[model samples]
Target: MIANEIKKRVLIALLIILPILMAPVDLFLAPNYWVKSLVKCILFIGLPLILNNHYQWVSIKSMLTVTKKQLSLIALVMIATYGTIIFGYQLLERWFDFSMITVQLESSMAITKNNFWFVFFYIPLVNALVEEWFFRGFGFLTLKKFFSRRWSYFLSAIIFSLYHVAIMAHWFSPLLFTLLVIGLIGVGLFFNYINEKTGTFLTSYMVHAGANFAINTIGLYLFGMI
Candidate 1:
């Protein structure tokens, strides 16, 4: 029993630290978007799969299951998520200078007009799935087994929000950056709640995808692609 407790503690440490460490890679090391994506996949997707093999912390089969009611909730949440994001963007555009995001994406990630479509599709679909699987499936749901509901929710949410800090560094004004981080924490909590209700991260993934859809739509407009 002591051995298992020690192992759980070690796993928790890794779960908390690995993504924090990966933030630097995104911020400083990765030269382009594909490199960043590959590193993220290896760290987020690969590590979780490997750890699950040894620990059995998550049930892949159960996580995939969804009911009709859950599906309806997913749809509603997704629409609301998309609408909320788009509305927020429109409301804040005048004050926030969001066009800087487009400039940063292009200069930092090489996200040009040619590759924007691929990124647009990838962000909302594939990237969101990877995040849901990592933050919700591995981080929150798995940690909930060893921690209290509140701690699990807050730890997972805070880490999820922090993980984006490196990516958004210098992308916004200080006030906007702070606000965005707080908003992310709220979104993380909402995603956790959806996963808790549905017994799966897939529901949260759909909502995340919707949120990404809104962001990428703004990206499209900024790129003058639409």
Candidate 2:
């Protein structure tokens, strides 16, 4: 029993620490976008598979399942998310220089007008899947087994938000950065709630995909592709 307890603690610690460590790779170590994506895939997707095989922390089949009710909820959430992001951008763009987002993307990731369509689709679909699997499937659901429900939700949401700070560190002003971090926390919590309802991450993934679609739409406008 004691050995099992120790093993659980160690696994939880690794879950928390690995992501914090990965932040630096996003901020500094990764030389390009593809490299970063590959590294993230290894860390988030590959590592979880290894861990799940050993610890049985989450049921892969359960995490992938989606109900008819969840499908309807997902559609509503996606539409609301899309509208909110688009409207928010329109309202905030006058005050904040969002064009720098495109500038940074081009300079850092080699993203450009030509390849943005590929990136647009990839980010909303693939990136969202990776993140939901990591943060909700592994991070929250797994942690909920060992920790109280509240701690599991809060810790997962916090780590999710902080992890993105490294990714977006240079993208905004200090005030905007602070606001975005708070917003990310809220979004993270809401994602947790969605997953908690469906016993799966697909609901949150759909909502995340919609939000990314809105952001990528804005990106298209910035690139003058629209």
Candidate 3:
């Protein structure tokens, strides 16, 4: 079962990694929006849920059946974190008027205009939810069962960081990439901590969704696209 889970993870990684690898080809050469969306949905999100050998830290029924207490706590943390993200982005933009991060996000602005529904809905909803489900849900939880808890967290953080590295590799400089990796690893650890603390993946998913929502929403505002 463990070996099968490992194999499943490897297969899932290829699903995700191939899209990241072919991003330029997809975006520049062919330019098929639906194809890219399908990859993100089926490969990244769908298969993870269907693959039986891997982790299911929070059962589907539990995810659906959140208690009143869980709902309140999730709302509280999400509100606080959402405020902090807007605050942090505002502060950071003041210092760095132009940034690699901004450049990366600007590229995504086309999606908001071209496919308003996908950007406004899918990005803040499905994309963010599945990422937490995949990285924190599957990666961190599965690793913890196999290794020391700290090692599990550390390996999970590394995997999370490395995944971003593939997506952002060609888009930034060495220095910028290093900083981005460091930042993502920190996010991975924090998300993992919240998952453990709340004893539910919903908190992490909510927070993750909030963060991505802020990024795209604020990016459009700053870029004068909205």
User: lDDT of all predictions, in order shown?
Assistant: 0.87, 0.87, 0.64
lDDT of model 2 at residue 187? 95
Model 2 clashing residue pairs (backbone): none
> Which lDDT tens digits does candidate 1 get at residues 1-226?
8867975786688778888878877777885998988888888889878878887776888888999988997899899889988898888888778778888898878899899999989998889999898999888888888889999999899999998998898799999999999999998999999899888989999999999999999899998988
For model 2, residues 1-226, the per-residue Cα lDDT tens digits are: 7866875786677668878878888777874788888888898899878977887776899889997977997999899999999999999999998778888887777788988999999998999999998998888887787788999999899999988888888888899999999999999999999889888888899999999999999999999999
- Residue 128, model 1: lDDT of 93
Angstrom error of the Cα, residue 8, model 3: value is 9.8
Query: What are the per-model C-alpha RMSD values against the true structure?
Result: 1.2, 1.3, 4.1
Clashes of each: 0, 0, 0
Please give each candidate's TM-score.
Answer: 0.96, 0.95, 0.74
Off by over 4 Å in 1: none
Deviation (Å) of 77 in candidate 2: 0.9
Provide the lDDT at 42 for model 2: 90
lDDT of 2 at 25: 81
